[model samples]
Target: MRIGITLTDSRGPDALTRLRDELADAAANGMQSAWLSNIFGLDALTALAVAGSQVPGIEVGTAVVPTFPRHPVTLAQQALTTALAVSGRLTLGIGLSHRIVIEDMLGYSFDRPLRHLSDYLDALLPLLDGEPVDVRRETVRAVAGLTTPRVGRVPVLVAALGPKMLRLAGARVDGTVLWMTGVSTVRDHVMPTLQTAASEAGRPPARVVAMLPVAVTDDTEAARERAAREFEVYGTLPSYRAMLDREGVTGPADIALIGDEKSVRARIEEFGDAGVTDFVAAAFSGPDAARTRALLGELATAA
Candidate 1:
């Protein structure tokens, strides 16, 4: 399985420099990729574009960018531009963000998210493939196409959790990107459902990219406490809640990869055994932040 680290950036001029240095460090430590999240921070695509200029020998991508705030045409344009600047090392992970951030916070009607995603990708995919898009859907319409200087292949992964989204991702996109979902859920629910859909559609095996909070520490209880405090909001999100319940986990901490080095490495191997294509280690906040990253680096080399 491919190993990577998740990056959450604070906004500033120094962010790009920090990302460049981080990518260099990751490459030096034998890591293969860096995943960035677009959760209320600098634009993920643009940030990656700038950082990719300074780094080499490692891939970079957005863990997820919300689909509601931007139109499909605009996104295609931006993604293509970023892909060009980054020399085609861009994995675009997208999703319909939750109601709390979309409706309550941004004041946009979080209406028919599944339908919106269905429409959104219909336009977004073809355009990214350097095809002329003329889609006419209920939630999205596009009559755009990329000009010259197109990317060869931009692998797209959807942040899909439920069965419907999994089916859609299996049928339409490269694979699925998961968060907070456990090994049992992936083995029983996600992998089976997605692969069945892929079989029906005559597609290749669907990619399962599982992003989990990870730490190498002796104080497992303290790690859980910190993970719970830092990621409590995810526990309240409805989609994440369903996955947690499926895993019989009451909170995010329960699903975290926190333990000593031996235990952490074993946890990562567990995900690989459960059929994860890529295991992206989210640098979970704790007393051993650097230790966690160092372990992830070592594991990447070992893998």
Candidate 2:
């Protein structure tokens, strides 16, 4: 399994400046990859490009960039530029963001998202493969191709939850990127469905990138309470709520990896056993931030 660390959350004008330093720290400690989350602050792809150049020997990627706003043509250009900056180390993780963000926030109609995703792949894949995308689809339009001598195919993983999206990821893209999904959901729902679809399409096995909250702390209850406060928004999101229910979990704290060192390490191993190919650790509050980071560094190697 591949082990990656989520760059510690930073939201400020200095966030971009801090990203490279964070990635440098992760790579120095033992992480193989560093993932950046897209938010109102730093642009994830841009941050990865900057971080990747400075932090050698560590893979850098966006946990996801939303697909609704950027056209496939522009998205392809941006992804290629970022990969070029990193010497082909960028794995583009794209997604159809929640309706709250898409229609409610951005004011884009969220009509037939599954269809939009299908149309998106049809246009985006060809561009990544260095072929001219001359077709127009219902949700995307493109008439361009990358001229930046294809160093190698930049892997694409879609953030998916439902069956149709998982199948779509398997059939077209390299794999799926997940957040707040549990072991049971991955084992019984995600893996089987994705594998079957890729197999039927005669494609190689698909990748499963799972991201989870992790905290290395002796005060389990206190850590859980802190986690409950920090990541409460996810519990209310419909897609995340469905997955949590499937895991028999009451809240995000239930899936969080919080315990003494040994127990925390064991929980990470459980994810590997459940068929997660890549584990992204979102380290939360602990007694000592430095100690927590040190523990995550150890788990990252085993991850």
- Strongest candidate by lDDT: 1
| lDDT (C-alpha) at residue 171 in model 1 | 91
Clashes of each: 0, 0
Residue pairs clashing in model 1 are none
Whole-model alpha-carbon lDDT for candidate 1: 0.88
lDDT of 1 by residue, 1-303 (tens): 989988767668798888778777777878788888898877899888888877876788887999999998888888888888888888899988799999999887887999999999999988888899888898888887778467678889999999999999999898999999999999999999888898899999988899989989888889889999998999999999999999999999999999988989988998899989899998867778888888888888888
Residue 129 miss distance in model 1 (angstroms): 1.0
Tens-digit lDDT string for candidate 2 (49-123): 877887788888788899999888778888888888888989999998889999999999898899999998888
Q: What TM-score does structure 2 among the candidates reach? A: 0.96
Go through the candidates in order and give each one's C-alpha lDDT: 0.88, 0.85
The residue ranges of model 2 lying beyond 4 angstroms of the native Cα positions read none
> Once superposed on the true structure, which residue ranges of model 1 sit more than 4 Å away at CA?
none
- RMSD per candidate (Å) reads 1.3, 1.4
